[model samples]
Target: MQPFMNSPENYHILESLDSLVQSISENQKEFFQKVSEIRDNHYTLVKSYYEESRRLIEMLKETAFLCSLMFNIQDEKSICASAINILRKLLENPVAIRILSTSNSHTKLEILAEESSAAFSIKSLCTKSPLSCIAIKTCRPIIHSPLESAVPCPEMMESPEQYAHICFPLIADGVAFGCINILFEHDTDIMLLKRNIDLINILAGYVSLAIHNNRLIKTVKKEALTDKLTGLPNRRFGMEALQNEINRSKRYGHVFSIAMVDIDHFKLVNDNHGHTEGDKVLTLMADLARKCLRNVDLVARFGGEEFLIILPETDIDKACVVVERFCRIFNEASLSDVLNAKNLTLSGGIAQFPHDGGDVLSLLKAADERLYLAKNSGRNRIVAGKLN
Candidate 1:
């Protein structure tokens, strides 16, 4: 203070410079450490999330494909198997799967898909916080958790073991008709879960759409080829189906029989009672024909008051017996008596595959010849084969 008083400004400047350098060095070290922490966190989060999203997408796609198989058959086995495979793939970390349907008054939970399925595990599947209905679903991008398991499914006490779950719902017409859930052995992050959910929803929506489309296609196809009154393949569908079956029999070296059925004096019933009575008779005849055949047989409304039967693996004799029994059952069911419409009777013409003729047109022509003979000979009886 005494000596530097003459040049105090210079001394002060030197001291301030030293202090500034120290402060900068300390800040740099702290910043570098922070950068390292952020880098590590980003790596884990990005990599895991990416892998999980990819896996979920793949599983969902596979599930969609599997569900598509339902269009092929009326049985439950194939459809259920396809659903299981989808859940097993999507929820590898989960203990099981539980499907819930919301199309009715009560929420019906169906175990459509599962892997290592628990005898009882409710905690992993549902909770009040994110009720099955409240759960989010998407046909678009998902950036958040779609379902919550925080409240724990109220049905948990009815189950066994610890479980967590994610849900995929099938929505149509603004209604959530069905849901698919993944049961996990542990809890998960809300954010990551939201992403997983998005993937699942995309899958669910696609599958639901496909199923709906296929169902509609089936209904339309049935209607197009079927006679609504008789529940038989309509003329349009009958021809194509017969042609296809004819080819199948020849290619496979299997015997088949074709029969054309007509109501004997059907026009008289229409004229006497009304068309209503005639329609009833037609329906009854189809029902009787259906009851007489094996699972592989096909029946079609060949035309007005006319029906045809395709019997795979059957010869002319067997076809004749089948038709005869069908007629007997018709008499037993007694539709005309029950409805009080008209007492009905029928005449039929039968032909064996290959033996009767080589093709659909040829076989049909031969059967028509027999039918003509039967009608002229006197009605109410069967005309089978070449009549030889």
Candidate 2:
């Protein structure tokens, strides 16, 4: 049997066994290659998912920050400032915010806030040709590189050639109210901006809503404190302002003055002329008073045909001078334009702080008493002191 195994006929069987072993070895090698390839593919998929998830998480945090801005900030400038800060952090680039307001069919761009890490001054890009801003004209997001276009935006010509620029129009209720301008320092930064477009858009939306809410709040507050007919501060605001002035005077030992003003024969104007004309008279008086008084003075409509003026850092003589000047201007105004009557005159009584009284009630009472004396003695002159 051992001799037969070594013979030429038996050698063919050994060759067949060897061939089978070689075929199995090749199949095992191919199988291992497929398994290794599949493992590599799985690892790539997991890494992609992880990166996407991390990006989403960061976006959520950023969105939450913008949402907080809506509730916390009330001033428009402050809101823009906060938005610019957060945007600079998220984009890792310089940022500027501008608001466009439409008035009389003309658009104006105001640069509200800016944040930059670079050592260059960032100014309003649309100062010369606001209408030429393509982003505002199209109401779309604009990604611009000076090197890529033949004719760049007119406003963008002054920007550095090394930096890329982006503009995101802030639209609310289908109207573009403002834009967020970003400066990309490098090509990689531009790529980053492209990848994070959706996130930046969401940020723009939040900022738009914040500005809208702030304007609404300011309008409501103005309407509440303002007199509708004369466009002056109403009685409630007047009293609050008086109290505030009193507090300031007491704290700083500063001398101030208050005056009670009355429109002379205002009822006769209403009775002779129509109430519409009377409204014009009130408006005229308000305009004249505002024009004559300094910016630090407060002229409020205390009641019908009555005004309370608070003059800060003014004594009795200066207060009297202010009222006398206002009276001159008020009397010289053309009343015949709106009404068939003579010129109007104003009677005012002035009182100094610490000389009259310390509190709002006492000061008001003293001024009112002097005003009554002015009305009884004659109706055209201002009285600064009580009768002896």
Candidate 3:
């Protein structure tokens, strides 16, 4: 070992050892730096994942609550009120609902229901043209944030810059019939709405479905209570109206009147005019009765050729005025063309609550008796009581 250390090769071996140590030191520093960077990245990823999971769970909870709220409500107004409440809770702002109605085959946009806290009218925000609403036109949601430099939609521009507007088109089965409009009183954070946008969308869908189902229910109920041939309320509905009037009169100590009207010799007309013409006469009578009666009055088809008329807050004398007016109108209307006779006329009998009878059957029986008297005495007149 001493002999080797004395040679020049010893110096070269020491230099090589020193170079190897320096290279190892440099590589160790780089490896530790890379490890530190990887640790930080993993923490960031974990934090991001946690945040996302929390948001997803919150969204699921909100969706479940909304579905539960919309489940049992059958009234359209009640459904809208529930929807507005949930949206207000979420955004801490006022909400409004607008629905589409078709009349005479024309679609009309109207505000069906809204919250009282709403600062602006739903009609004011919506223009006459449905296309003006961006959400409705595109069948998508429009989010106007305080952070945005420019408001994209004109409807959103109607609100002050300090207020954030969110509009979600209520679409179901590819039909955009309505929208849920929220006007945030404060400058809402864009992320709050963005994070819950899907929740809002699901809410909109539930609203549309609920409203559609409600309308179907109402239509079915209306059809059930209405007569198909004469387009008037049927006997069952007439009885209901009479009972309601009786209850209201009894509660308030007021008086109401009911009139039993019968077409003169309706059986003879049907036998002679072949039922088709008889139907025409019935329709004509309904139209004429509607013209003669006031808005508060209810005229329903009682049976074959008879109609029941309810007059609220009226006495026998006032009810006679109404019955007489109806008789005049019936006489003046052209009935000869359908019946081939000039004798077609109307006979009516009037009865008042608490005066004629207390209950529905008693009042109906009294009215029927008077109606029989009118028919026996004269076919074209009204009977209020025992003929004098």
Candidate 4:
């Protein structure tokens, strides 16, 4: 019984099973190949999406940096510089070449910043530039072909032969502060400019806010340092100025002088007359001191009836001469008619750098001591020199 080994039925069954196994193996291989192709395609798509997202994020970061540059700065000139820098960055496009700027309520448009091969005479933009005028008037952004339009700006006329122009208004709170003009080659993709329109608008808003905030800060700072009644620097500002002078003198090894001045019989005047007259006297003293001192000198109201004057590059002797000259003029002046008093006089004490004292506190103390000495010795005299 070599048995059924040679049976045709068994052989046929074995052949059928072999065929089925081969078929299953081929189908499995094809399924794995299809899965691999799908995986590759998915990876490619993910990579593309990630790269695009990264690029967009970088652009947004750049925009944020530009806005920060505009907002963080507090000076008009610095703001202008920032705006120019942004223009330079935006102009990095091969198509963009020039920029112009103008302010609201201004008749002339100026070439703020530009980068081009040709010399541009576009110094001013006339009202005839319909694009810029419309943008400013509407407080909006406009895109147009400058070459075809009636853009009477000399700069635009001189601009590259074929170009597109974009004008954006810097507006905040319903007020247009300024406008920015940009130039691009005619062949530049309009879609690209359209894509950046929102970003440009955001930058304009930041610029407007920066200018407004800078002005407000300047006004506040001036008010902080100034005396309301005398129109002189207040004590706080005087102290800061004195410290600065000290630092400067130390650095340059130069001599400077400071004086503490007091009005003679100020209390008596305040008592006899009303406070209104007292205020007037103070104001007059400030004006007189301002007139007497050189432009390099600084005068500040230290306290009631007391003023501090900082004289740069002056010695004790020169300070004494200056104070004496001022006193003589003040005493001889027709102040009686204004004050309802026969005479109005001033007393001052001088302190020189490194001679009287080295630091602000020491110098102020020394000057104040001499001022007391002058008051004790005589009401209307100046005391200067090293302490005895």
Candidate 5:
């Protein structure tokens, strides 16, 4: 009311204020939209992570089951089956999943699992896919960089698509065993894929541990049943082994023989050279005995200075020939080299099963008594025995 002239100025000011308000409103709308998008992306990531975590937990449980199963499995076929089931579950990819296996002796950075379909896919891309080498080279868990922007496949290389894959090395005891390869049908975002590498490492560690532990347990069991001193089966183990062989032979209607072996003057050497040297002499004798016998024969140290040899699929006559050969070999042992002894010799007593005795105890007793007879027969001869 005081100044009409200033009204124009006020109007201009109002117009500027309106424009600022509109600009502010527009900016707020854009900010909220961006925030919503971020939340959606975050939710998707979290969901994927949770799903993968669930899969991992299930895989670990299966590993536990496998651990228990391996304890009793002696044959190799069962081992393969258990491992395959686990891999299929872990990969769960439409692409083929392959497990690359290695031994304790194999010491190369390797993939424990592979999808040959990656090879096929890459080959389809350039007829020469570099996928195989690329997978082999990275040794890290995943490879997704070249996917969004892929190059031509190498001629020597072979894969079906311009796709990349995840490669995890299966390692144990600081040894690179092999790798497990996982390929996706579609390209995955690199950063997200890379984040899962830690989980892959965890899986690889478990795989290595399971395989190595199983193998170690089997080896330890074998060593436990074997005599370290004589490279033979110990008394208890031999009896057990003999029982198994006997059962097999009985089932097949085959014949087998058991022989009791006694070192002729083992005590004299032990008495002269102390137990340590005595141990060495015993070891040497064991090696000699093992060398003298057939691969199928089961020889064991029954006790101090005594051994048992079981010949499968053999009757009395055939048993005699083998026993005599072992006797001759024992007599010619290089005891002098180890015990510094003037001479070394062994005597054996032969007992044919189902002839000398029907049961384990009876056969063992008959063999023992015959062993004494061999000592009486002249400390270095085989005494073929009939049951007392």
Candidate 6:
């Protein structure tokens, strides 16, 4: 035996083992390359998603400012439109459809606005949708999967694919004003919505405050222009309206008339029956004037026991007829008993654009001069037309 270790058989066996080890090393190198490529692709996807998220957050901030602008201008329609536009932008990914829901006084959730592609039809949610009810009642965010639960409405089931639904309640000061619903198509990253929950909540806050402030502004404006006692436009508003009508007449060449009406023996009634009864009489007169005038006419309280009426598209002749009818109606009404007097009557003076005088001041002066004449001529009568 010449050195068994140097035998050809043994050498061949050693060569085979070395070849097997080399093949295993090559396979391991190829596997690592595949893993490295997969990791690079994942990182690229993550970077793209992050950039998109940052863009959406910037948009949300801009939307908040837009809501502020709409509130400042008191444009309710623009507010809704702006909200829809911002929502469409923010929900580009994951979201296939969006719906804005507002609670009506009738205790029903009304779809105020919506934005969606043509492939999808916007449908009303079920009245008994538990998820929506819960979100509203809790004033918090609710998320659910329509495929796993029955929370989805019939419209949501149209796709029959896995989808995520989110509802964010528009709440401020513990009051739920409304909710925003977002529907996500299949394979959407639920994490995206989760990450933006805080931003969405902030947007909801902005919307709620805008709507509340707008309503408050409207109420204040209405109160400022209205007479507290008689519920008619006050003298300030009347003056402004007169100026507007003057401009309109000048621009359009349309005729309009003004009547300055005074209550006869009004001071005596106030002195005898007290200011409370006087207030009642004023309110009664306002109601009578509003009821007797045409829908196009504007009646306003000029001052104490005085009313200014604007008759658009009417010449002096038609204005006189309207005023005469009002006089007859007031004289025949049962207001005499309310005033505790023998007769309650009105004295009116009429002035027409271009006919009596041009411009607001001229027309007002001419009407006032005639009103003076009516008071001097008789306690109950009308003074109209030019004086020679």
lDDT of each: 0.66, 0.80, 0.79, 0.76, 0.67, 0.76
lDDT per residue (tens digit) for residues 1-388 in model 5: 6575479888898889999999999999999999999999999999988997897677567666665565465544454455556555544343544445544443322223333443453223211222343433455454543556544324223444634555565566775545555555655555655645665566566665666677788789889888776667787799898889878877888778899888887788778877887787678768876677899998888899888889988887788788888777666665345456656777878888788877798888888898898898788887885644
Prediction 6 TM-score vs. true: 0.76
Give candidate 4's TM-score: 0.71
> What CA RMSD would candidate 2 show?
3.3
Task: By lDDT, rank the candidates, best first.
Answer: 2, 3, 4, 6, 5, 1
Which candidate has the top score in TM-score?
2
Q: How many Å off is the CA of 145 in candidate 4?
A: 2.8
Per-residue alpha-carbon lDDT of candidate 1 for residues 1-388, written as tens digits (9 for 90 to 100): 5666457796888788888888888889889989999999999999988997787667667666665565564433344455656545544455555554542344344444444544654544443222334343332321222144355434343343444545566666675555665555544455555545554665566555655565577788888877888877788787787889888877899888888877788888888878997787787777766766777888888888877788888999998998877766666665545555544667789998889888889888877777777888897778994675
Compared with the true structure, the alpha-carbon lDDT of candidate 4 equals 0.76
Model 6 stretches astray by more than 4 angstroms: 1-53, 61-73, 93-134, 150-166, 172-174, 181-196, 336-342
Model 4 lDDT at residue 20: 99
Instruction: Estimate candidate 5's alpha-carbon lDDT, on a 0 to 1 scale.
Output: 0.67
The better-scoring model by lDDT among 1 and 4 is: 4
Off by over 4 Å in 5: 1-84, 92-165, 169-199, 273-277, 335-339, 385-388
The candidate that achieves the highest lDDT relative to the unseen native structure: 2
**Which residue segments of model 3 deviate by more than 4 Å?**
1-37, 92-108, 114-123, 131-167, 172-174, 181-192, 335-343
| Residue 301 error, candidate 1, Å | 1.0
* Candidate 5 vs 6: which has more lDDT: 6
**Model 2 TM-score, all chains together:** 0.87
Candidate 1 differs from the real structure by a C-alpha RMSD in angstroms, to one decimal, of 6.3
Candidate 4 lDDT tens digits, 55-110: 66776689778778776777676786676667566444534433334534365555
Candidate 2 lDDT over residue span 1-388, tens digit each: 5796788878998999899999999999999999999999999999998988897787769676766756588887788877776676666645444444443344566676666655666764555444777777788788876556645566777876777778888877887866787776535356657777777777788888888878888899999999998899999999999999999989999999999999899998889987887888889889887888899999999999999999999999999999889988888884556545578888888888989989999899888888888999889989997656
How well is each residue in 103-174 modelled by candidate 3, as lDDT tens digits?
A: 223254466666645355545665344556778889998887676874657755665656667778877668
Pairs in steric clash, model 1: 94-184, 120-160, 124-163, 126-153, 144-194, 145-194, 225-234
